[model samples]
Target: MGVFDGVVSALRSAGCVFAEEEARLLLAEASSPGDLARNVQRRVAGVPLEHILGWAEFAGRRILVEPGVFVPRRRTELLVHEALALLPDAPQPAPPVVVDLCCGSGAVGAAIIQQAPWVELHAADIEPSAVLCARRNVGPMGGQVHAGDLFDALPPALRGQVRVLVVNAPYVPTEAIRTMPPEARLYEPVASLDGGPDGLDFHRRVAAGSLGWLAPGGHLLIETSQRQAGGTSAILAAAGFLTRTVHSEEVDGTVVVGCLAAGMTQG
Candidate 1:
């Protein structure tokens, strides 16, 4: 059998659904036969393909995704789409400020700037590895990356100036995490996956703190599962935002958007 055939067989035997596609990608990444062999072994051992490739395609952009960092998922493109929809029209003196919380690899923020080059972007993550990786991706795009828990990572100067806030925080319940695919449960960090008991913990925190940071009439967008979308919207409403849920059947994605009233500029 040819080298490609052998690699596909190894990947298929290891339970990879898209064995042919994975073999092609693995072959493209391997510069030498030894490298190809090593990559195949790693794939067989269950390392995520994105982690092996060191990048992920999100919103048609190649986002740098380092090992141990949370890989961006295709569903998150819906969050980016909704956030872009909420942004006010362009052509202004000062560009609208955008902040991405729990930014991981900064895929969402990167995608935003890719479309709207005028945005002042900032991304933050609590994990050191994520912060470092995000910097590599967001920095080249002229966006800043911060390391800290949630809003704390952002500069104090950004308060009340943020026009758009996007978050993709952990939403998997502690108990439910056990049922997640091994690519997430085994490869991704627990802090990046666990969301306390009901998986709405970060939603509550982000919603409660969002009002003080959002500009007048600014919008907050959070990625969540369809099952948890209602709860996410309810939390935003309770925190004084005008909330709504948006879903994409094509991508099977859900996003909760909260808008601060135009009349209430300050908290």
Candidate 2:
């Protein structure tokens, strides 16, 4: 069989739903016959294709993704869309401040900057690998990537200055993680997937901490499953934010947006 057909057969046998497309991508990414063989072997062994290729296509950009980093999902684009919608139009006195909390590969923050280059971008993650991977993707775009736990990773100067805070925190219920695809459970960090017992741990934390960092009238957007959207909204509401949930059926994306009232101070 030809190279393409052989790859397609191998991927198909490995239960890759889009075997042909993956084959094409692998072929294009391969530097030589040996490289192609090694890539195919890895894919068949259940390694994520993006890890092998060293990047993931997210929000119309090629985001660098290191091994063990959480791959950016298409659904997370909803966070970027909602954030851009909240940004003020051009000719402002200064660039608006934006933060991507729990940033994995910094894909969400990078995409936001791509759409609104005028915004000052900062992204942070607790995982060292993710922080490093994020730096590569957002650094060139003038975005700062920091390392630390949620909220702590940010610079103290950013307090009360962030105009749009976007988050893609882990929302998978702890017990449900084992049921996730091997590509995720086996490869990605558990810290990037486990959302505590009920899948709202990080949501509660983000909402509770957001008021102090968000500017008056600033918005916080969090990506969550449709089933968890109401819970996420409620967490924000209890934290003194006026909350709204946005759902995109096309990408199966759901984001909960919380706006701090213009007159409210961090209490």
Candidate 3:
């Protein structure tokens, strides 16, 4: 059999759901026959294909994804789309500023910038690996990457000036980590996957801190599971935001968006 056929067989035997597609990508990325073998081995060992390829496609853009960094899921594109829809039209003295919290590989931020090149993009992640990876992906877009807990990593000047806040924070329940696919549970950092008790920990924290950073009439868009959308919406409402939920049946993605009313005082 040809190398491609053999590679597909190995990947399929090792539980890859889309072995043919993965094999094609691996072959395209491999430098030689030996490299193809090594890539195939890594796939068989359960490493994420994106990790092996060193990038992921999000919103039609290729985002750099490094080892141990959270792989951007296709579903999270819904968060970007919802955020893009809420961005105010251009006419002001400055472009809208956007913050991507828990910005794993900066995929969401990178995608936003790709679509809205005028945005002033900033992305933050607590993990060093994610920070480094984000710098690579976001820097080229004229965006800045910060390493610290949510909100703290942003510049002081950003307070009350950010027009958009997008997030794809960890939302997997603590216990559910053990049940996630091995590629996530074993390859990605726990801090990037565990959402504490009911998976609303990050949502609550993001909501509480959002008012201090969002501009009047700014919007906050967060990715969440369909099952947890209500909880996320409630947190946003309690934070004084006008809350709404958007879902993409095509990608099975759900995003909860909260908007701070124009001229409204912070609560």
Q: How many backbone clashes can be found in candidate 1?
A: 0
RMSD of each: 1.2, 1.0, 1.4
Q: What order do candidates take by lDDT, descending?
A: 2, 3, 1
* Stretches of model 1 off by over 4 angstroms after superposition: 262-267
Worst 10 residues of 1 by lDDT: 258-267
* Segments of candidate 3 deviating more than 4 angstroms: 89-91, 261-267
lDDT by residue for model 1 (149-246), tens: 89888899998999999999999999999998888889999999998898999999998887778898899999999999888989888888888888
- Candidate 3, clashing residue pairs? none
Q: Give candidate 3's error at residue 236 in angstroms.
A: 0.9
lDDT of each: 0.91, 0.92, 0.91
In model 3, the worst 10-residue window by lDDT is 258-267
Clashes of each: 0, 0, 0
Q: Count clashing pairs, candidate 3.
A: 0
- Pairs of residues clashing in candidate 2: none
- Scored against the true structure, residue 207 in model 2 reaches a CA lDDT of 89
